[model samples]
Target: MSPYLLIQLAALGLYLFLVAVNWSALPEPMAVHFDASGDPNGFMSQAWGAVGIPLMVWAMFFGLTVLGRDPGFFARMKRFSPSGWRAWAEFNTLMGLGLLTVSSMTVLYNVEAIPGEWIGYSVWIFLAFAFLAIYRLASVGR
Candidate 1:
């Protein structure tokens, strides 16, 4: 298995574990969205709050895994050539992991599992690292 896949799987597992451990403690309607100040600005039922974002994250992971395995898929998309598909997949996986980390932290914050001004800072850091990773991947096989 690819190391990227392993990391993504680990992140998914950790996210599921966190949700399982904190599910019951989450309020009926949990804060699913936050404003610039890190204050809750939107809400959703506990079911959605706990599962929705993770589901989306999992979908991205699955899709990217499929795309990575089949570089030919990129040939149909004018934006990318088959030669660059693997690197694109690598970049996607990196971003996906970053997103998973941010989502997990957001969930934890909403459930009050961990506290502080984390969401904002974490996002900035993730974006910076993601861009750097993508740049490095773009230079691969050149």
Candidate 2:
């Protein structure tokens, strides 16, 4: 499997593991959102908080991975040449991996497995790395 696929799988697996381990410990109505200062500012039922975001991440990853296998689809949408279409597909998959990482970390934070402050800082750092990855992948074969 591709490194991107492996990373996505590992992230999703880790998220599921974390959620399972913390399931019983988490409050009934969990904090799903945080303010700039890292305080919980928004909330949702524990079921949604634990499972909903991960499901969405999984769906997005699956969709992007499938799309990556069909360059013609992206080409038709964006007028990319074959190689450009391939690059776009890879970049989309990379973005999905990044989202999985961020979402997993956020879930961990919400479950109190990690420090609240780490969420914001880690997200910014992840964004920087994600941009770099996208730039490198998109520039391939150019």
Candidate 3:
């Protein structure tokens, strides 16, 4: 198995574990959205936060893994696909980790395990990673 896939598997396992153990501790209406200052501005049921978000994350992992395996899938998009598998792996790893980070942070913040400032920071950090992924994709083949 690819190292990226293994890392993704580990991340997914950890995420599931976190949600399962914290299931009861999480508030009924968890804070699922935050404002510019990291204050909770929107809420959703714990069920949605715990289940719906993970579903989306897993969907991303599934899509990335499938596409990575068939490098040709990306090759079809000649304009952006990088020439090497490393670029693809990095893209997948960064994206999967980014999703897990935000979702896990949401859980931790709602349980008062982490401060609100970290919430805003995490989003910015991941946004940087998203841009880095694009840069790697664009630069690798050149």
How do the predictions measure up, each by TM-score?
0.81, 0.75, 0.88
The lDDT for every candidate, in the order shown, is 0.74, 0.70, 0.83
The runs of at least 3 residues in candidate 1 whose Cα sits more than 4 Å from the true structure, single-residue gaps closed, are 76-86
Which of the two, 1 or 3, has more lDDT?
A: 3
1-142: candidate 2 lDDT, tens digit per residue: 6565666677678777877887888887887777777777888887777788756867676667666666565655454565664565566566766666666666777666888787677668767877876786667665
> What does candidate 1's lDDT look like per residue over 1-142, in tens digits?
7666777778778877888888888888887777777787888887777788667866786577666676476566555654466566677777777777777777789778766368777778889988887787666655
Ranking by lDDT: 3, 1, 2
Every model's Cα RMSD, please? 2.8, 3.0, 2.1
Candidate 3: Cα lDDT at 36: 87
> Which 10 consecutive positions of candidate 2 have the poorest summed lDDT?
76-85
What is the per-residue lDDT of model 3 for residues 1-142, given as tens digits with 9 covering 90 to 100?
Answer: 8778888889888988999998899999999889988899999999888778766877786567757768567676665443556677778788888888888999999889998889899999999999989798768766
Best by lDDT: 3
Report clash pairs, candidate 3.
Answer: none
Give the top-scoring candidate (TM-score). Answer: 3
Total colliding residue pairs, candidate 1: 0
